[model samples]
Target: MKNMTLERITEVCGGVYYGSEADKKKEIAGAVIDSRQVESGYLFIAVKGEKVDGHQFIPQVFEKGALAVLSEQELSEPAGPYIRVESTLGAMKKLAAYYRRSLDIKVVGITGSVGKTSTKEMIASVLSQKYNVLKTEGNFNNEIGLPLTIFKIREQHEVAVLEMGISEFGEMHRLAEMAYPDICVITNIGLCHLENLLTRDGILKAKTESFEHLTPEGTAVLNGDDDKLCEKKMVNGKPAVFYGIGKEAKLAKTEQGEKYLAEKEVYATDVEPVGLDGTKAVIHIGAESFAVTIPIAGEHNVYNALAAVCVAGKLGLSVDEMKRGIESVKTIGGRSNLIHKGGMTIIDDCYNANPVSMKASIDVLAAAPGRKIAVLGDMGELGENEQELHAMVGEHFEGKGIDALFAAGALSENLAQAVGKCSKETEVHYFKTKDELMEELLPYVKSGDTVLVKASHFMGFPEVVGQLTK
Candidate 1:
């Protein structure tokens, strides 16, 4: 809320301030776009969303004791201070950018085709050891959400871990403009947003834009195993810090076997063990190490831990602090959340999915001790290669030792068929509707089976996750 006075906000956003001249210097306690969350002295930004227009609730927010309002449409002689902008969302971003500048906190911005959220959680956990930290909540990594996350920063926070997600060109630039992060972490460049970015090279271009507003002295931490990210020349003329299981990485894994790595600096190859009930890992970073166990699954989580360790080390957090913070990290709602119910274990990863993540989830399912049943739905926004990608996912299921596969959505039919052709041992079923699929699955799933449900957000596969847990 620092430097969020009406006069300063108006100056930053270049809006026509239409209110009492005496209230120009009045301060706002907070900013919100949702009327339900509005509080006294809060500035309500009237954003015209797809489902609901925020302007419709302006009067309600004013009644709730809002100090000011930002509107796209003009009001007929407003009662109190208000700012009229051509676009309320744009103005909100501008105001947020200005507010972000007022804080002396270090902002660590993370982005990638996959694992951004998990990596954000890991980084925030490690940094929270020594500092008061605020991180991106839920899927609030988009333009609107990023601004709102910035608005959540309080005076007590010493560092802000902001996750930046983009599906098209120019989105990251806009997000970075508001964040201006002190440290930028690119989890990896993978086949996501191909609808907008077109190719992996395109993905790299879009994901790396986080460096656009980075401070000159800021660091760009990248996945050394990713061919695209590893080839980057420089970020703001500073060499990129790479971490991965490969030899070229500054923080590479050295331990033997599938799970444990023994090398020095934040290696995922170290023995980071997770029980069937939850996640557990011990990470080594530059003359320091800590054992952290979380309530999440998948080997990919180790990389998330590595990214966090690198960021925390850069911020000067001690080894013990990192250990405690990582151990305290909990499972996020939709991302890789493990729900146990009725003698079955459900890996509810229905938040979102890509080819990379789909395969990773399969790996976790393959590791489970009981009969593994994968309920997969359509993965959206993959451009012209959608069919091939869906088939590739199906092939992964075919090769894995999964007991059964239930696929929903138009694209997933191809997946089911692909699995059927490749593997006779696995039973593949496809459904056009979620109701149809659930009807069939509910009767087949045994008490001892382990179910993994995953798809993009649009597929609404969380319904399957909910049913399994219930």
Candidate 2:
């Protein structure tokens, strides 16, 4: 929002100004796509959506004191002032990229098959200790969303921790071009968006596109434990800072086996899982060591902590500051948020699903101290073998000490069948719809049971979580 005048915006977006000469030099307070949020001196981007067209509300926005509108359609009669561009959406992105370059700030761009948002939250929490940080809110990690997020950055923000998610190739390239990150974090290349990416190797190629737009001296942080991510030798001629757990982690071994370690890499040693409460581990960054308790479950979170520690160290956060920051980290809704109600514990991980994330949530559900109930749904975008991938998750449920399984959607039936085949004693039920599952879910749930509700966002499993909590 700084140094943003109507004249500069018109030049940055490559639009012809059709407004009054007096308004050309006027500065805008902010920019938005939605007309309803328009205020005095605001710029409205007329985005065409499936349900409602933003152009139709231009008159209303201007009446409410909007300074100008970026429009694709030609207006017969002027409403205050407007800029004409070939495509409003394209102009919005171009404007965002221009604004990002105009600011003097460090950006940490995060992307992966899973845990992009969670890792972003962790890194932002850690970095907030020393800097005035600005982070992406909710699921704004795509082309349109990333630009909107960039527009939120004020001059006061010293660091921008952004999450970039892509379904196929070229998406990350466009997002990276806008962010032009100084630090790149690739959580892990896992099985996600396989319908577009094809395989894990394809995922790696798609995810690493963040390196394309990274600064010349940018640092690449990666997950070394992953077989595919470990193959990377260097990014932009700079050694990558790889963080992970287990023997494969370079820092724990104290000797770089592959020469992939950056000037600094991190690892967690003497790991101890404290049931569902969290994990206590000694995080090692280069030669320095700090013992901290990650207030989140799953071994996967230990990797998140290490990733945050990597960023915090680069930002000059001391061991004590990082420790307090990690302790302050909290879970986001529908992404491993632990809720307790009706004398039962619920793991609300139903925001989205894939083979890797489903298994990770199951690992967390396994630690519940009571009867383990897994309510899973179909994982979308798994390519042609989506059923097999769903069944693979079911296989993890069987013989893994799961007490019951409630599955919905067509693909979830495969999961139920596989779990039933594996665990004869574990109660397994398949529903054609979530409505049917909702009807019978309460009857089967007993007091002191640990219930995990998870599925792809399209599956609408959050409704089931709502029913249980109600």
Candidate 3:
């Protein structure tokens, strides 16, 4: 919004301007693809999707007081002014990249195989204690979503905690170019997005593409416990900041080319999981330490907290500030958010899942008091080894003292069989569809029972959580 005048937009996007000269120098209030989000003076970008074409809403957006529209197709005698580009999405990315260069904001670009959203929230919470922070909202971390998130940054925001997600190789590179992060954080290179990436190493290489766009003075914050990440000593001529739990001692010995020296280590100790309450830990950075409690209900959240500590430390925040930020952080829905309704406690982690996250959620459910039930579904984009991955998650539930397992989706049938073979006493139920599972879910769950609903986004397990919570 700084220098985003109509003339500047046309120049940056290389689009042909088709409107009055009076509006050429006018700066837009905001930009959006959705016509419903269009406000007075906002720029509407017309994108053609599979189900709907945004061009159809151009007339409606102008009536709603939109200042200008970015279109890929020609309009006949349209309202207001418009710019015609070869591709609206490509134009939007160019606009976002230009806008990012105009801002004096410190961006924390977060990406990994998993835990991207949770880590973004943690970093934002910690940074907000000292700076006016703008973080990515919801699952808007893709190419389109990342640009939209960048467009939301304003003059008042001091820092932008952007979550960069990808399923392919060059996607992160494009996102990172627009973000131009001052600090890059890779959560962990787990078994995710294997459909396109094929393997963990492939996933690591793809996720680290964000580093290519890191500013010269940028720092890389990595998870030391992760074998793939711990080996990274330096990035962009700057030593990486490594954080983890139970891996601090090894950090110093981790080989860095010819030298065996640790980068900057921020590790946690005395990690105590408080059942559904969350996790308590002592975070150490250099000679200082802070005793903190994360009220988000999972041991995996400790990694998220550690990532936050590493970032906050780099940003010159005090231990007390980090502790308060870590403690005050609240869970977003579908990422281990705790919900109480209909006489039952539901862990609605149904937003998305990989084998690692699925097992992590199971650990949370296993630790809860009373009857522990796991309602799981298929994990998408796992490539050819998807069955083995699903079965691996099922094996994690074995001997965890889980009361019952309700698995939906075809891939989860492998999960059901694996859990049954390993944990003979655990009641395993397989449903062909989530609707069928939902019908039986309510009857199986009793008062005071703790239920964990989890699956990949495509599984639509939120509806199952909805039924139970209702």
Candidate 4:
């Protein structure tokens, strides 16, 4: 809330300030766009969303003790203080960007095809060991969401881990402009947003846009295991920190090799998976090595942990701090979070799915020690070969030792059929809708089965998980 006041907001956003000239200097306690969230001393911005025009709630917010309002249209002799701007959302973003620059904190901006949220959580968890941290909450990682997330950063916060998500080229540039990150982290470039970014290389180019906005001395933490990302030696002229898992024999061959060389790097060896309990791994940083148990399952999470360690090391965290941080890191819900209910284990990873993430979740399901039942839904924005992609996912299920496959939505029908053609051992069922799937889901799921529910967010796969868990 520092430098956030009626006067400061007007100056930052270039708005026409009206009424209570004396109140201009009064600091607004908070900023919001929704009238229902209005609190005492809050500044409410009237954004005209697709379904709702927030201007209708301007009077309501003022009545609820809001200090001022940002109006997209000029009010006719307004009774309360207001700032009239062409667009409220635009002004809100500008104000947030200005406010971000005013703060003396290191912002670690996270982006990639997968694991943006989980990696943000991991990095924030690790950085919290030595600093007062504020991370992006919920789905607040887009243009509007990113600014709203930035508004939550107060004076006490020493580090801000902001996750930046984009579906196209310009989106990341816009997000990066507001975030102005000190350390930009790319988890990996995968086949996501192929509707716009047509290829994995295109995804990489769009994601790395965050690096262009990094501080002059900023660092890039990359996943060295990703083929697309591993080759990059520098970003925006600054050398990046590369981390990955490699054979122990290769660790000693650091003889001026370009692939092995990095500005700073960390890798893992002796990675031992302990099923649902989590993973035990020995992380190596130069000569220093330590064994740590990451409190999460999946080999992919090992990379997530190493990425956190790389960032932590860059920020001056000691080995013990990194160990504690990695151990303290928790799995985020809908991003491979494991849940046990009614004698069944549900891998509630139905948040978002790409070809890469879908396969990763199946790999997690493959590791479970029970009859594996996968409930898959449609993956969105996959471009021209959407059906082919769904079939590819089914091909993954084929002979993978899956006991049952329940697919819902239009695209997933292809998945069920693909599995059917490939194997008779796996039972495949298809549903036209989530409701239809729910009707027959319970009977197919046995008590001892491991259910993996996953799909893109639009498919409403969580409703299916809800039915199974209920």
Q: Per model, how many backbone clashes are there?
A: 7, 0, 1, 0
- Comparing 2 with 4 on TM-score, the higher-scoring candidate is 2
The order by descending lDDT is: 3, 2, 4, 1
Model 2: per-residue Cα lDDT over 57-158, one tens digit each:
999999999999999989878678899999998998999999999999999999998899999999999999899999999999998999999998999999
lDDT of 3 by residue, 99-202 (tens): 99999989999999889999999999999999999999999999899999899999999999999999998998899999999999998889888989998889
Clashes of 2: 0
Checking candidate 2 for backbone clashes, the offending pairs are none
Candidate 3 or 2, higher lDDT: 3
Against the unseen true structure, what C-alpha lDDT does each candidate score?
A: 0.83, 0.89, 0.91, 0.86
Residue 193 displacement (Å), model 3: 1.1
Identify the runs in model 1 with alpha carbons over 4 angstroms from their true place. Answer: 246-265, 272-282, 290-295
| Per-model RMSD to reference | 3.8, 3.0, 2.6, 3.4
Tell me the spans in candidate 2 whose CA falls farther than 4 Å from its real position.
Answer: 247-264
Better of 1 and 3 by lDDT: 3
TM-score of each candidate? 0.93, 0.96, 0.96, 0.94
Question: Per-residue lDDT of 1-470 in model 4, one digit per residue for the tens?
Answer: 78787888898888999988799999888888878888999989899999999988887888899999899888876658999998887888898889899999999999989989988888998999999999999889998999989988999999999999999988999999999999988998877789999988888888888878998889999987676776677788877788878632132232234343232368888898887668899998866888999888888888888888888887888889889998988776787888888999999999999888898888778778889888899999999999999998888876578888888999998889989988677888899998888778888777888999999999988777788788
Model 4 scores a TM of 0.94
Candidate 4: C-alpha lDDT: 0.86
